[model samples]
Target: MLKLDHIVKDFGNHHGLRDVSVEFPANQTTVIVGPSGSGKTTLLRTIDFLEIPDSGRYQFDDLDYDLSKPLTKQEVLAARRKLGIVFQSYNLFPHLNVLANITEGPVQVLGKNKQEAEAEAHDLLKKVGLDDKADVYPDQLSGGQQQRIAIARMVAMAPEYMLFDEPTSALDPELEVEVLKVILELAKMKNSIVIVTHNMDFARGVADKIVFVEDGQIAYQGDPTTFFNEPNDRIKAFLAAGQFNVK
Candidate 1:
């Protein structure tokens, strides 16, 4: 399980995160949904140590971190490895082929040989339904295929948590389903998966829990059944404004 208490972060011009607290159960999908600039991305970054919080405490499985003090570079990197972050952009090495991109981290960072890493990469490619695209470069694939490659790269890292920052937001509307399908498969892998997304329909389909954030804070957190069927006025307003088309 992952737990956060009193997370606080301040950007130069904004409250990046504000006294945020939440818990994520193991082997479950937790979707953080809200408007743009609502601190959903910031919260995920802090958990992965991309953004340092001014104050907070996080418990990830057996590891616990105090965010009140500064963390060293090594400490930050270590934390990041525990929770792999996949962003809006695929961020694959465009110069490299899909197999190379997926195996890069394992060979370089995880101390695995090319053969071993390639084996893992092949398995992940097959898992993401892209086994045939192993030799293709990022430019040769569609947006959704590129995103799946990015996800496969993270799976090779073997992290306990996968932090996704709008993984499908960059794709064309028609291309979104392909990426969402891979995400749904990841959620079923029995790891704690946290995603920040505007895709309400995808969230409802996969998330065991949903969190609504606004103004740098979590306005609500509940099971999907409650969040969709019986939301507070705040959530109702948000859903109405976005016309999320929840079903």
Candidate 2:
């Protein structure tokens, strides 16, 4: 299981996270939702070490780390091999084609052969509905297509845990669906997945557990059914403003 205890992130003027503690069980999809600047993204980033907390204890199965200190290069790389993250901006290599972008991590980081990596990349491309785009670069694809390719690239590494930080926030509503579809599919297949998104409809459909963050703290954490169907006043207000669908 993945767990955090009393995690705190200070940004001088404001706190990104304040005495936060949560657990993300294996084989469960956990979705984090909150209003803007409520530390939802910060919580996700901390899990993947994109942003180190000022004070906290992070534990993943056998490994444990004190978040008060910066991690060594080797420590970060070792941890990252088990964790994969996709940001809002699809950070593909402009110089490399889709196939190269997807194969790079497995070949370089995981020590897989070029041929094997390429073979898996092709299969992943097909999974994302973008097999034909393997020869194209990031600049050539649309926003949705690029995001889909980004997902494929991350999945190619086959991390034990997957993290997405507002992945569809940058796309148009139509384009957002394309990315969300791939993510939903991943949530179904992957063992551990955490997503931070504002789309209540997608969150309700995809998450096994829902975590509501408010003012740098977790306001609620429970099964998605109760989270959406039996919301408290604060959650009800959030749902009313958060593009929620009652049906």
How much lDDT does each candidate structure score?
A: 0.88, 0.91
Top of the candidates by lDDT: 2
**Which stretches of candidate 1 lie above 4 Å from their native place?**
245-247
Q: Which predicted model would earn the best TM-score? A: 2
**Stretches > 4 Å off in candidate 2:** 245-247
What range of 10 consecutive residues in model 2 has the weakest lDDT sum?
Answer: 238-247
Q: Kindly provide the TM-score of model 1 when superposed on the true structure, using C-alpha atoms.
A: 0.95
RMSD of 1: 1.5
Query: Model 2 over residues 1-247: C-alpha lDDT tens digits?
Result: 8999999999999999999999987888999999999999999999888888999898987778888877888776667778989999999999999999999999998899999999999999999999999998999999999999999999888888889999999999999999999999988885589999988889989999999999999999989999889888898889988667543
Return model 2's CA RMSD, one decimal.
1.3
lDDT of the structure predicted as candidate 1: 0.88
Clashing pairs in 1: none
